[model samples]
Target: MLVTGCAGFIGFHTARRLLTEGYQVIGYDNLNDYYDQTLKQDRLHLLTTNPSFHFVKGSLENIELLQHLFTTYKPKIVLHLAAQAGVRYSIENPHAYVQSNITGFMHLIECCQLFNVQHLLYASSSSVYGGNDKIPFCTTDRVDQPISVYAATKRSNELFAYTYSHLHHLRATGLRFFTVYGPWGRPDMALYTFANSILKDEPISLYNNGKMERDFTYIDDVVESIYRLMKKGHLQTRNTLHEIHNIGSNSPVQIEYIVQLIERELNKKAHKRYTPIQPGDVKRTYANLQTLIQAIQYQPTTSIEEGVRHFITWYKQYHNILD
Candidate 1:
């Protein structure tokens, strides 16, 4: 199996789980300094100790390196999770999104087609539900109205996957993940950033005057869904190869409420500055998990409080913050 972005938050967990299941994983990551490099390196170090794991450091833009990897590993399954991840980051560096998410994905699909990879599971984002007023965003929703470049790129991935699947008979599955949070979560994510700010006695920025909302799906639930989807992909009929499913908590939480939860867990109060909604930021995101539930019998077990507590616990331990 080949796992791109294996050092990333979700990718790391997915690779670790597969390795634990006795599968040989070829982990690929560029270790970009999007956030803290130490965190990425730490995740990679944990995977490197495993005998079943081999790590490769390179960007998706490197087609030659990608081809070399595909030819060398000849992996039967490819999990494509690497991308220019953040929505706001995409605005500042739109070309990064194009180079990594679009061009890089093209290179990857080419390798998959040439190598005849059995299954290609790629990451999509709930932000693809941009400008969607409907609660509980569903797979059937028309995602033609993306407000951010990152979301646009993700939506393009689904379309490109379907086209490739139809033309080449490639078995491709796209999972549209919603605001994932957990212990080893990304620093840029809402949970981590809010916690960091609150802990440091810094004012946390509240957009939309604290009226925003997000479907905060926990990491375990997201990972479990991926695992089941991979297993289910084998028996699935070819007709369903070009399918997209929403992976989220189903229940949406208000942004202000999430801040309170983080404060409670951290035993601190946050100084917040409420402001209008930022450009490229959506007002709300709620996932309609019927498709996921029907496919994998997925039931999110973690609540916002539980997830926040676990993250703060890990955050304190990671930063060596002692009271």
Candidate 2:
């Protein structure tokens, strides 16, 4: 098994899960300074402790390195979770998205084709839905419009994977993840940022006057879905080699409710500053899980309250906060 971006939040958890399942994992990551490098290192450190996990410090942009890794391991399944992630950051660094998400993704698919990988499971984002007023977005919904470069790249990945599946019969699955959060979450995300600001008595920016809703899928649920899908392979799909599904909690919670949950967990009041919604920011995301349930026979089950509490506990321990 080859897991790209193994140092990242989702990638780390996914790699750990695979290692625990007794799979020898080839973990690849660039360890970029997109967030805190220390956090990435800490995640990598835990994975490296397992004898089944082999870490490779490299970027997907380097086709030669990817080709070398593919030739060496000849991984049967490629779990592609690597990308220049962040919606707002893509605006400031559009070229980075082009290089990493677009160019890097192309290199990856080419290698997967040449290496004859059995299955390629890659991460997509709900951002591909754009600012649609539609509730409970479905897989069949039109995704011709993407607000951010990050989203466009993700949608492009789906298209590219579809092309490969059609042309070369490369079995691939694209998981369109909703707002995934929980323990060891990204610092740039609302949950982590809000908790940190509240702890420091700093004001947390409330975009769109905090009038937003999100399908906050838990990390564990996301991993479980990926594992099941990977293990099941193309058994469920009778006709096509390419498939796409929305992995989400199927429950949209208001932004205010999330803050309240965090405040309750931390026993602190948040300082809020209402602000206009940032560019590429969506008003809401709700997943229609009918398709995912049919495929995996399951959906994300972690409730917002429980997920928030778990995250707070991990956050406190990680930051050495005593209270």
Q: What is the C-alpha lDDT of each candidate?
A: 0.92, 0.93
Q: Largest lDDT belongs to which candidate?
A: 2
Number of clashing residue pairs, candidate 1: 0
Q: How would you encode candidate 1's per-residue C-alpha lDDT over 169-218 as one tens digit per residue? A: 99999999989999788999888899889878999999999999999998
lDDT of 2 by residue, 175-261 (tens): 999999988899999899999999999998888898988999999999999999998794746366899999999999989899999
lDDT of 1 at 129: 88
Model 2 clashes, total count: 0
TM-score of each: 0.98, 0.99
Per-residue lDDT of 178 in model 1 = 88
